[model samples]
Target: MKYSELHGNIDRGFNVFLLILVSSIVFLLLNIFFYKFQDNISYFE
Candidate 1:
């Protein structure tokens, strides 16, 4: 019983870590793209 509980906890933690990594990467990429777009528009003004 104890072993199973430990295994479950490890799996949950790993999943949460992956979720965070993916979200961070997506957010950073979107931010970079938008920033470039903004710069281009401003330059044309």
Candidate 2:
């Protein structure tokens, strides 16, 4: 039972880590896209 509990905890931690990693990547992509969009707008002007 203790082993199972430990395994469960590890799984939860891994999932959280993956979530954070994915979110950060998405945030970076959004930031890059926003910057590019702004640059295009300025170019048009």
Give lDDT for model 2: 1.00
1-45, model 1: which lDDT tens digit per residue? 999999999999999999999999999999999999999999999
User: Could you tell me the lDDT of residue 33 within candidate 1?
Assistant: 100
Task: Show where candidate 1 strays beyond 4 Å.
Answer: none
TM-score of each: 0.84, 0.98
Where does candidate 2 stray beyond 4 Å? none
Q: What is the lDDT of residue 24 in candidate 1?
A: 100
Error of 1 at 28 (Å): 0.5
